[model samples]
Target: MLAADAVRVVAFAGLAAMIVAGRASLPLIIVVAVVETAAGTLFGTTEHAVLRGIVPAEQLPDAVARNEARGYGVSLVGPPLGGLLFGIAHTLPFVANVFSYLGSMIGVALIRRPMRPAREATPEKYGAALAEGVRFVAGEPFLRAVLFIAAPLNFAINGVIFTIVVSLQRHGTAPAVIGLTETVIGVGGLIGAFAAPMMQRRWRPATLTRLICLVATALLLLSAVLMTGVAAAVPIAVTLFLAPACNAALFGRLAATTPDRLQGRVLSVIFLAAGSASAAAPLLAGLLTTVWSGTATMLIFAAAVAVSAVVATVSHGLRQPAPELTTTRQAP
Candidate 1:
């Protein structure tokens, strides 16, 4: 992960230099994007593993909640800041991102504790190790249920969001209004992050998960019915407001249940599933919007999420409490 961070810093710096020198090419940009994405995946997986190692079980919920809040808080600033910097100079935002990566590298370097799990007596091959993680998650009912609902839910929600953006663009919505809409969503996320720890204490993970799904469905339905950019923004903001609590509960349960050594693999699998859906969302949105009106496309997306919510509510596996696991740091 440290190496990945270093690579990311260098990649961003190189991109910035290329842009500044007026020497950026399509192939160079594509190569840098691929490297940056791979590095980010490595960094994120390692970060999750390290968090599990360093934080004690009892405090993990709060720790993770705070981390979520910090990330959302950054989102509140980063987009607008990036826009401002870009306005000043095309390369400035990339330069700023490089500095951010450097800061992350420095922070990682300062961590005093061991990050890796203790070595096994006879380590499994890479493929076998990954397969072991997949089997473990698949065999677990709660985790399986999460994966089932999460993929389609993500697909629909992201598709709807893309449709909304494109619809707004077609309608010639002012750039400031669009920016404000995103800022509202960011503020909502910040509020959710602040409330997540308390919500976790008040509700079980299963109950919280159900509520999240239901609320998202309602919001999407409302957005679809309204069929206005401002109306859509309202629902999106409310959904974002509730999102952090749901994510915190889900991740806290995941961290509590999975063994330290398998944390990275398990998280990687979950993220990959959700990411695959998100990656296809824009294409799906475009196809749907072309076939029907944007409002109709949104309604279809809302229906899809509603189906996921219904499944989540009725699923025996999702309703059951997640299995408890020891939170003690595994010996290294």
Candidate 2:
């Protein structure tokens, strides 16, 4: 992960230099974008795995909530800072990102504890190791339900968000207004992160997950009907306000239920499933908006969320308390 961060720092520096020199080519830009994305993914996965390893099971929820809050805090600051830097110079933001990556790398390097899990008794083939993670998640009903509901929920939320941004742009809304909407949503997320530990203490993970899904469904439906930027933003803010608590409970449960050795692969699979859905959402939203209108696109997104809510409501897997990890099977 530190190596990935170093690579990102170099890539950002290169991009900044190219922008300053007016020599940025399409291919170069594409390459840098791809590299940065890969590096960021590696960094994120490693960060989560390390957190799981370093924090005790009893404290995992609060630890994860704090991490979530810090990310929301960054979201609150990063956009305005980026815009300000961009106004000063087009390359300035990239230059700042280079330093950001370097700082992250330094922090990672400063960690003193061992990150790798204790070595297993028997070595496992790479494909078999990957397959084990798949089997583990598939065998767990609660995790399976989470995997199922999260994918569509992610897709719906991303589609609606992209649709709103594009619709606002098409309707000649000021960029500052659109940015303000995002800032409002970020504030809500920050509040959610701070409240997550308390919520976890008050409710079971399954219960919290169900409530969040139901509320999100209603909010999305409201956004679909209202269609105005403020109306859409209000629901988005409320939904984000509940999101961190949901995530802390869900992820903390997963961390407790999976063996340390499988943490990286299991988390990777969970994220990949949801990310795959999100990756296609912007294009899907754009197509729907082009064919109909933003209102129609939002309704479609709401329908998707509604389906997820129904599934969560009915799934026996999600209704029960998550099972604890019983044994660490050696790789065979």
Candidate 3:
């Protein structure tokens, strides 16, 4: 996500720079988008490598969760900070974002971790290592269990409709209102993240996610009541919190399940699925907005959350009570 975010940030930055310099073009915009996406993909691959390498086998899940929490925190803070930087100089955000990639690369290089290196390859084995890892994740019980919740949670509930900002704007809401609404949502996630360790003491991470999923689902269902301004804002804000909370738990599970040797590959596969869903949902959302009732759109997202909960609940493998790893630094 950090990497993918940078792509978006740089694309915007590059575009802003062009606009500020009065040298913008359609082609340039496209190029920026392409570069950003490519970098993000690479970052995803490398990031998993770093985490999987560094963390001990028993500690992968919690590490993944903590990472996700930090990510959510960043999401919570970044937009406002980006806006502040942009306010100072049109090019500042993008220029600063480009350097972010460099910093990430530097960090990755400096980090020491125990990663499974590619086996000695025969001529026929060029990409076999990658393929092997993908297949392993595809079959792994714990990792697969996460997809049951994480994939739909992201694709349907989170990705199925316009972003909250877009949704508000579509309803002719103002920026100040959007900012306040967003802040409320971020606060929820932040609170959830801070409480995660303790939350795990009582409930499995998956259990926590299930609870969050239900609340978030209820919130979305309520959002269908959004014929008026009040109905629309609260659910969306709640989702922001719910989504991050669920994500934090899910990442923790993923890390726990992934073998140290295959962390990079497993993480990459997970990210790839996310990227694909992200690529797919906007088109679907646009299509739905054109013909589907607002109630229908809300229902679609609600169903996604419901189904994820069901999957987590019934998956004989995942439904087993979650085990909280009390030893936090078992990996680092």
Best by lDDT: 2
Alpha carbon deviation, residue 44, candidate 3 (Å):
2.8
255 in model 3: Cα distance from truth in Å?
A: 2.7
lDDT of 2 by residue, 97-168 (tens): 999988887888887766656778897888897889899899988789889889988898878888888888
In angstroms, what RMSD does candidate 1 have relative to the true structure?
A: 2.0
Model 1 misplacement above 4 A? 330-332
What TM-score would every model get versus the actual structure?
A: 0.93, 0.93, 0.79
**lDDT (10s digit) by residue, model 3, range 241-287:** 55544565566566555555566777777777766766776667666
Taken over the whole model, the C-alpha lDDT of each candidate is 0.81, 0.84, 0.65
lDDT: worst 10-residue window of model 3 = 323-332
For residue 124, give model 2's deviation from the true position in Å.
3.8
**Candidate number that wins on lDDT, 1 or 2:** 2
Candidate with the larger TM-score of 1 and 3: 1
| Candidate 3 global lDDT | 0.65
The RMSD of every model to the true structure, in order and in angstroms, is 2.0, 3.3, 4.2
| TM-score of candidate 2 to 2 decimals | 0.93
Estimate the TM-score for candidate 1. Answer: 0.93
Q: Which stretches of candidate 3 lie over 4 Å from their true place?
A: 1-21, 56-62, 112-127, 160-167, 239-245, 320-332
